[model samples]
Target: MAQLEQFTTPLDAVVSRMRALGAALPERDGVAVFNRVYLAVTEEVGRQLDAGRFPDPGAAITLDVRFAERYLSAVDAAAGGSRPPACWRPLFQFRRHPGVRPLQFALAGINAHIGHDLALAVVDACRSLGCEPAELEDEFDRVGDLLTTLEERIREDLMPGPDLLQIADPITHLLGAWSLERARDATWAAARALWALRRLPELAEEFTERLDAAVGLAGRMMLTPLPG
Candidate 1:
């Protein structure tokens, strides 16, 4: 009960922050759109944690909080007019552009979160827990699965009605180029690689930078402005 309380306190705080952002920003604003989607996912994860869905409750809590902090940190950086990590720059930079669709904003946020944040979060959890990447694998997989399913729903809900959507649309093609499953897989690989290089701080930093830049490139592509 104490452990749950400890985790719930911080998790609840994060959710409250997201909720405030959702309420304050315009519905069509790209960051607001993505914030709503992410807040839903975060709330669901919190419920699962409370219901004892995770095998290692402590590890799960650690990873969940660490993962969320990365996103929240990006939000803080953007709000302060400071540069966030490369992986997150695109979403904030193009967030208000009328040409970018809501679905694009949601997916771009997921890309930055899963592709870059998750990998680093795994490392953070490992360091904090004094365990290993293997110890957190189950928690990672469970979280990834949730995000994977949510990605589908985000597409379905945000997609334009049949009259507005067509096979020839550029947004369709751009979205087709990215896959949450592939991104999750690559992130797992990156997590493992970072863990392996944990002893070499310099090498790990370089690897992380490359991963961030590559993911940012994908995000930039995903956010490509389209004709309204």
Candidate 2:
């Protein structure tokens, strides 16, 4: 209980920062679209933490904070005129383009965060807690479950209606190409691989780089501009 309380301040700080971004960005901006979705999800995670929903609160907090910090760091880098990782560049670069749909923005952000940042975050939590990926599996599953639910909600809320959607729509094809469940599964596998390769710094570095580039490619595809 005491340890859990210790995490409240930092967790609250992350939530506050996300809320500020949600409010500050324009509604139609791609970053803003995704920020709103992410902010709501963060708030829910915080609430779950307060309600004692996670089996291991400390692990959960560490994973949540580490996950959020990656997104925040990218935001800071863009604000400071520095380059964010390739996985994140597409979303930030195309954030304000009128041709991109809100659903694309939301999913692109999710792809960058989950497909890239999440695997890294699992490794981060493992290092922070001085444990292995196995030790954090419960926390990882819980967080992934939350994101899965949120991803469904985001699609429902942002996707065009059946009347607006078409079989030949580019967005439809893009949507068909990605799956949040698959991403979550892959991230778990990546985390386990990273933990196993912890002693092989060079190999692990190469694996991480490849993972980043592959995820960035998927994000770039997700951000493909439509014929609005």
Candidate 3:
């Protein structure tokens, strides 16, 4: 009970920071677009936690907080004029480009968070919980499931109207190639692989770096400019 109490403050702080970001950025700004989406999801997670939806509330909170911190840290880094992780560079770099649509911004942010930060966040949660990735599977699945639902809503809310969009739209093809479900699956694999290589610090570092770079490349592709 006391351990769980320890996480509550941090979780509240994270959500508060996200809310502030959502309030501060321009609604149409790429990072703000993603921030609004993420903020809604975070608030939902908080509600679920309050409703006792997670079997392991402590583990769930720990995972959720750690996962969010990674994204927030990247935001902080960029704000501080320091380099964020490679996976986050594209969205930050292209955030204000006139040609990138709101949908691209949202998905690119998701790609960086889920594809790169998530695997690392899982490991962070494990270390904090004194458990392995397997133990966190239930929490991970619940969060991932929530995100899958978010993905659907993002598409519904941000995507162009059907009348205005068609099979040949470049944005359609660009966003079509990336899937939140696939990213979740890969992140799980990466988390397990990272856990396995925990003893080999050098190798683990290299693996993480490569994963960061690969996810960043994908994010860059997703952010490819298109005519508005």
Candidate 4:
């Protein structure tokens, strides 16, 4: 394959990051870490969107939305007392960072974009399902409004900042504001988490095995109702 381009435009930035990650990962692993490399490349997609850098978007954008969906699942799992049940098709993996630190800003960035796409995805699906044309157009506009705000926030956050919002979300702030320290920390924390989650599908085989075991047990239990 051709070497990943050194990105100049914001659109290129996402692609370059993905290429960088593709190099970092081991070749033996399966689907689990596949998307992981992509996150490293696309970490800046939000920043680009915020800057009106969306250019020639394609399947990659939808794929990124899938990346966000995994974390939405993670957030849900976190809110509940259990990890969401693993599936071969579920596209993310758990990552154990070396230290406990706030990576919420990066998560916020990915989540923001994911949400932006999810709104669009709903409408896209509606259109695919033959929903009314005018209603679909309205939803498109609504989704556009949301994406506009999300992109703006991402851009603002990335700029250099002593601002409160940037401080509040250090991970994403650099898209608008450049901070060596925040970028470094994000490299370790936010960047790593996002990368790991993206490649989560690679862990599918192991997860599927574990899931099968759980299902087997559940099946046996179901064969005999609880005895008081």
Candidate 5:
């Protein structure tokens, strides 16, 4: 019982912050669009935690909270006029562009989060919990499954109606080129590589920077504006 209470504070704090962001941002703002999607996922995570669904509740809480803080930190950086991480730059830059669809915003955010942040979050959780990445595999898989399900719903809900989805629609091809499953797989690999390289600070830093830039590039491509 005490352990559950211990896990609740951090999760509740993050959930509260997400809810505040959802209420504060404009409905159609790209960041807001992503924020709504993330808020839903975060709330669901809390529910799962409360229901005692995770095998290691402490590990789950650490990973989930650490994962969310990275995104929120980027938001704070941008809001404070500091440069956000490379992986997050495109979404912040294109957040209000009329040409970018809501679906694009949502996917771009997911791409950045999964591709860059998830890897680091794994490391963060491992360090905080004094465990190896392998120990967190179940937590990672469960979270990935949750995100995968949400990705499908995001596509279904934000995708244009049949009348609007013409063969010539660039978004159709643009979105098709990226796969959340592939991204998750790559992130897992990256996390393991990072854990291996942790002893080599310079190499780890370089690898992290390169990963951030690569993910940011994909995010930039995902946000490619289409003709309205």
Candidate 6:
């Protein structure tokens, strides 16, 4: 417990610094932050790879899907007739950090496994709505599929041989492949949903339900918090 606490202070400080840095970050800087976060998360996941101590990536993806739904409800309430905010551009901007390319190898692999699981959750969520979830489902589903593709495309590089991560992440290669506009639309939809939920409690019930589910999943993932 004492040792765990030691890591907390440093990580919190790093995250605080990252946020402070974020204030001055240009569009590219946001991508840098994402890359850094991805690296850190990937490293942590890699450590867990040996023992599989981490929660399933698919589960994490599912949690995010629920977050999106909650955000949608909230956004709808917040804006009313006003146009929804643009969130996808910022997110895409965040996804392609330059200096942080070192972590791409790990992200591609871990994200691949989780991406499919997350996509399934999205499809299920859409089905529950009684109408086709064209925008939301398509947008998020693309990310999962892309991650899966990234996994396969980069598998060899990530494995033994030479390291390709230092040069560029597979995602970076997709640049010029996609117009920033596509991501911008999705980002706006997601942000609007989040902003809306914060302002409207009644409509934000989904957020609470999903949060509860996340906690429950955590508990279920491990019978207890202690190490095996």
Ranking by lDDT: 5, 3, 1, 2, 4, 6
TM-score of each: 0.93, 0.93, 0.94, 0.26, 0.95, 0.23
**Compared with the true structure, what per-residue lDDT tens digits does model 6 show for residues 44-82?**
333433355434433333334443343233235433654
> Which rank order by TM-score, best down to worst?
5, 3, 1, 2, 4, 6
lDDT of 3 by residue, 26-137 (tens): 8888899899888888888889989989999899889989999999999999999999999999999999999999999999999999999989999999999899999999
Off by over 4 Å in 4: 1-74, 84-137, 157-228
Residue 17, candidate 6: Cα error in Å is: 18
Q: Write the per-residue lDDT of candidate 2 for residues 142-181, one digit (tens) a residue.
A: 8888888998888778777673655667778887789999
Off by over 4 Å in 2: 1-7, 163-168
lDDT for 213 in candidate 3 is 98
Deviation of model 3 at 197, angstroms = 0.8
Model 4 C-alpha lDDT versus the unseen true structure:
0.37
Instruction: For model 3, state the Cα shift of residue 46 in Å.
Output: 0.7
Model 6 residue 93 CA deviation in Å: 21
Give the best candidate by lDDT: 5
- Residue 32 displacement (Å), model 2: 1.1
Encode model 5's per-residue lDDT on 91-147: one tens digit a residue.
Answer: 999999999999999999999999999999999999999999999999999999999
Clash-forming residue pairs, model 2: none
Off by over 4 Å in 6: 1-132, 160-228
Q: Write the per-residue lDDT of candidate 1 for residues 1-228, one digit (tens) a residue.
A: 555324346678888888988889989888888888889888998899889899898888789889889998998998898999999999999999989999999999999999999999999999999998988999999988999889988888877657365576777888998999899899999999999999999999999999999999999999999987
- For candidate 4, the 10 contiguous residues with the lowest summed lDDT are 219-228
Locate the minimum summed-lDDT window of 10 residues in model 6: 219-228
